[model samples]
Target: MKISIYREKLKDKINNKKAKIAVIGLGYVGLPLAVEFAKKGFFVFGIDIDKKKIKALSRGNSYIQDIKRTALSELLSNKLISFSCDYRNIVKSDIIIICVPTPLRKTREPDISYVVEATRKIKDNVKKGQLVILESTTYPGTTEEILLVLFSERGLKVGQDFFLAFSPERVDPGNRVFNTSNITKVVGGVSKNCAYLSKLIYSKIIPQVILVSSSKVAEMTKLLENTFRAVNIALINEIALMCDKLKINIWEVIEAAKTKPFGFMPFYPGPGLGGHCLPVDPLYLSWKSRRHGFEPRLIELASQINSHMPNHVVNKVVELINSKAKHSILEANILIVGVTYKRDICDIRESPSIDIIRMLLEKQANVSYYDPYVSQLPIGKKSLHSIKLTKKNIFGFDCVVIVTDHAKIDYSFILKNSKLIFDTRNVFKKFNNSKVFRL
Candidate 1:
């Protein structure tokens, strides 16, 4: 095999910080990545289908919490970053990344429509020597099975004409300690040259890049990371149920276990697994495994258990309501303290609080929510806004459910005024309040 001229040229562009980069779907993953590259002096084209987001970026507004508006403003003024809804920039870029969403359909099947659409756009305008990488969370073989096939249909050879790789986005929203730049990036390419070029491009922005054998491994690496969390969380969720039955404090048990500091990692139980990855990624693997005649028994069971958590939480709410209000879930003024999947972030893709609210609405409960980070949330035909956490409002709700443990919210105020409290996150540790019922 000979050294490819295209690879060397790409390496030169990356090293010189002169690479023209196109990033599709500028949401949580893409915006941070594009900003990082632009901060590193690469000319980044931030593309998204959402014109609102483009308009926001055009005026130096940031829709993502982790990215600062000042950074975007500085970069835009310096002409290092450009935001648009156009895919025509694809032809002008040396490296193109697809950071689009890979959400599951209503039936819990993998919906790669966003990925397919982004890939199609790339294929329509992809030129020779441009490297394409997918940072979307997807099942193994998606890069080769879907992306490579789509690009090859455009008469582009993988390593020679265009390069392709999968570097799964390890974005933990609201995680201050580790981020898109410092976290180790795992890259797997369709070919050896593809992997090398992919690693090269990411190494320009992200500090650590690890090479895997193939795109399948890189794809599997992401699924495994989330599935591990989902499974362990399911185990802990199930144990929490057991502890509840045994009349034991699960939070206390976790604290005791943490004291060991070895062979024991504590996974807390909550409303359920939420966000983009944990609730959805494992099923993608299980779905693929089933297609390969392999039964991922543990994955299926864990998914079932995690999926039950939101309803379990609702049951806790019902239990609390019944103990006080002398009624069923019907007509109960249940307030959700925080609606986001996790604490202190606005991204609510596949959030369990949504599921809990949906289930509550199904049972005819009057549900309201409050989160400083989220202003409005749309559920079905009705939209719910975050309510004020005043004494009167807190007293109005029959029970308050702390779905997400946001730090800024005055928990003392909630415990002080609320009629009943369902503490899923153990926010009130050892308070021993009669109105506070913990999960």
Candidate 2:
């Protein structure tokens, strides 16, 4: 058979966990996944352009919250994993996985430059009998549009001389329950042989594997997952704004709806959508949708509502400052309790707290923050350090805003010490203090 040469060789290497795997872009998603592959006794080659990351990983120091330093040490001790900045090392690898970022441009269109660049590097070093799978979250046609064409330029036929697949990574930062070993790995490929080889490799580390028909379906699957959450969160955010106008408590409404337990999945409103998937993925889908001559109005509306939340939060603070404080808004002291995008993680990408602080400062309000995970934040030219969350520090502020409710923060202590509070995360739901206001 024509497929016997590449398929059988890959099957044997994967079955023995002897496959030389190369995982690119060691960030939130890439680092943890690379570690998992190492644990399974695979000779994993970790590649990234960041020397700081390579230095840390090479010395067995982990910068990500989810991957532990001890895991790196064990992997390094066994010589199961190696880190490098050079792409030429991939010439000896049997599999290459791309986990690079897919960000948006100033026009809000999908930016696949990172994906293209990674492909170009792979193109230079790509060899026959190597399986290339892209795990970066992108548009539907990206795998075929970029990977296949680039790799084939050097006369390597995909699925014959080399295998090609798209496996969308389902990595949730700080999610303890579903890590790489347990979550379902969704694989789709350009050909059945490509999908089979990809599944054989990923099945060595991940427990459940689902192979779809084509790479586009796998790409669309990942987008649909994030878009679903983005749209629903937007719907609830708009409802929260409606409740603010009607003197209704959105939290209480969500609690009431939770009793039914059927058809109602609660998505809380916040300063806005944060993290990588929710804010960015839907826009990828939307960009593709527009190109196909279809308008995703609801998705666009959701983005608008979620984006407006920080402004709404600022408006509430303005109302409180005018109503409760003797000082003018110019010199009012506003302390932000937490600064990270989500609770318990150091990730600050696309965080709404940044917007809230900027809006506050633009209003000439004094803004300082406290986050155990983040030490300091940059705004324009100046920087704001995480002040000590002491009683004296808490009392000095005119109003304290609970933007992110990290698990480590003492809510009761803050409630007792703050002069006035605007609770965005419902950290004060149990409290009956007259001075505590909730969004």
- Candidate 2 TM-score versus the reference: 0.98
Per-residue lDDT of 232-341 in model 2, one digit per residue for the tens?
88888899999999999999999999888689898998989888778999999989999999998988988999999999999999999889876677889999988888
Worst 10 residues of 2 by lDDT: 1-10
Clashing pairs in 1: none
Looking at model 1, residue 219 earns an lDDT score of: 95
Which stretches of candidate 1 lie above 4 Å from their native place?
A: 325-328
* lDDT per model vs. reference: 0.91, 0.91
What are the per-model C-alpha RMSD values against the true structure? Answer: 1.4, 1.1
Model 1 lDDT tens row, 1-439: 4478898899898888888999999988899999999988999999999999899899999978899989999999999999999999998999999999888999999999999989998889988899999999999999999999999998988888889999999988799998888999999999988999999888887888999999999999999999999999999999999999999999999999999968999899989888878888999999999999999999999999998999899887888788776778898989998889999898777788999999999999999999998999989888999888899989998999999999899999899998888999999995889888899
TM-score of each: 0.97, 0.98
